[model samples]
Target: MPSGPEVLQAIDWRQPWLAGWREWGEPVAQAVADGLPLHEALNHRSAAPVRFVPQAALPPGEAYERYIFNSGLCPTREGLHDFFNGLCWMRFPRIKTRLNQLQAAEIAAAGVAPLRGPVRDALTVFDENAAFLLAPPPLWEALMGKDWQALFVALRPLWPQARLVLFGHALLEKLVYPRKPITAHVYLAPPAIDTIANLDAWLAADLGADKLAGKPFVPLPVLGVPGWWPENENFSFYDDSLVFRPRR
Candidate 1:
């Protein structure tokens, strides 16, 4: 693995939001720099360097209060369990263009064969988190409208050990129904982050290898055409950021 500085440099870290994250994320970086194991820092979010603290490390009586989950208009509205599998359609044009930009020598240097159009398109939206926002209002009414508080109350018993942290633009749904009950268990963060540049880092920081190993970061089409509203796989919330992994 590359040193922290080298890893940071390999990617363009010029975004201003990342700067804000510095204060919050330092502890995380420090932990990685210190050679902490992956499982220890799996789901913790810190914007700076720090040591890892496993969930098991916490006092048995004291439950973990923080959980981060990104909620969205998944392909399957009700359970939406298989949503992750349908996300690849979002990576289109961009990945194709990126691949096309490579010179034959560059392709050889990269040690990967050029992809066929259909295959590229298939993989593009494969692991997408894009369609979440496109979910019909009826779906939002069913989920968020029921009130996050009620949902949490009912859902908590199923997973007693975990606290729920929702990661998505679903907070926007609150505006339509401000009276909706909010829950202590439900937390939200701005879903907009430039994913093109940060997908790798986001996975590195959020999911870690334990969760993301062998996974591919497929993009989603937030916007598409008629048959595929907000047409075009390239235009998506993913233009800013995305979550590419098994839906779980």
Candidate 2:
């Protein structure tokens, strides 16, 4: 595995999937390049509500979310996973805080168990693998229905009007080594949210325990998003049934 600095150096901040993160990521990357630790680099660049601390800051046996909730510190480790996680906190602080709040609440109510119960499970899933998509109803209908051909091919022109922003840090981390099978748990954003800031605020306000527990997300193959991967431009790309499964 590459060191954190190496991972930082390898990222192409200009990638469409990384939009809205360059402003924060570039400076943090430079700080790491200058020999700062990943957590310290994140601290140096962050104005978010939570402080970035070394992973050791998390006491052994304490729940991660519980610690963050109690201390307002995010324990971060070196690597693409935590690197993207820090970026998510920087870019979508409100949403991250809200998720942390919910997770901490669940931990408090039920204690950390082998099975996190439904609400905590959903929160973890969202934090690790969610994406926000703003598109026309037709695009959404096709996507939610798992009609990949119609979504990616028939409505291909409509992609110009759509915006898909990756929210899950794990999803972003996996894309560093792009694979056809990498997918996102997509949440639809209100069409009015035209900017990242607006989306952050809206999503933070929109998330609730009941809503999250329902797991209202549609699966989207990240590479299939128009313009995200060049190979996807070919109609044959969607024919990979393993990646683009039909609705049951």
Per-prediction TM-score to the true structure, in the order listed = 0.20, 0.97
lDDT of 1 by residue, 1-248 (tens): 22222232232223221222333334433443455433232224422122223334544442121110111111112111211111111212232223222222233344334452333332222222212221233322323443322222333243223212212223212211222122111212124434433432332234222222333332222121112122222333223223211222
Where model 2 places Cα greater than 4 Å from the true spot, the runs are: 1-3
Q: Estimate the overall C-alpha local distance difference test score of candidate 2.
A: 0.90
Question: How displaced is residue 171 in candidate 2, in Å?
Answer: 0.5
User: For each candidate, how many residue pairs have backbone atoms clashing (under 3 Å)?
Assistant: 41, 0
Estimate the overall C-alpha local distance difference test score of candidate 1: 0.26
How high a TM-score does candidate 1 get? 0.20
Highest lDDT among the candidates is held by which one? Answer: 2
Name the Cα RMSD for model 1: 20.4
lDDT of 2 by residue, 39-126 (tens): 9999888888999999999999999999999999999998889998999998899999999999988988889899988898899899
Candidate 1 stretches with Cα past 4 Å from truth are: 1-14, 17-25, 44-248
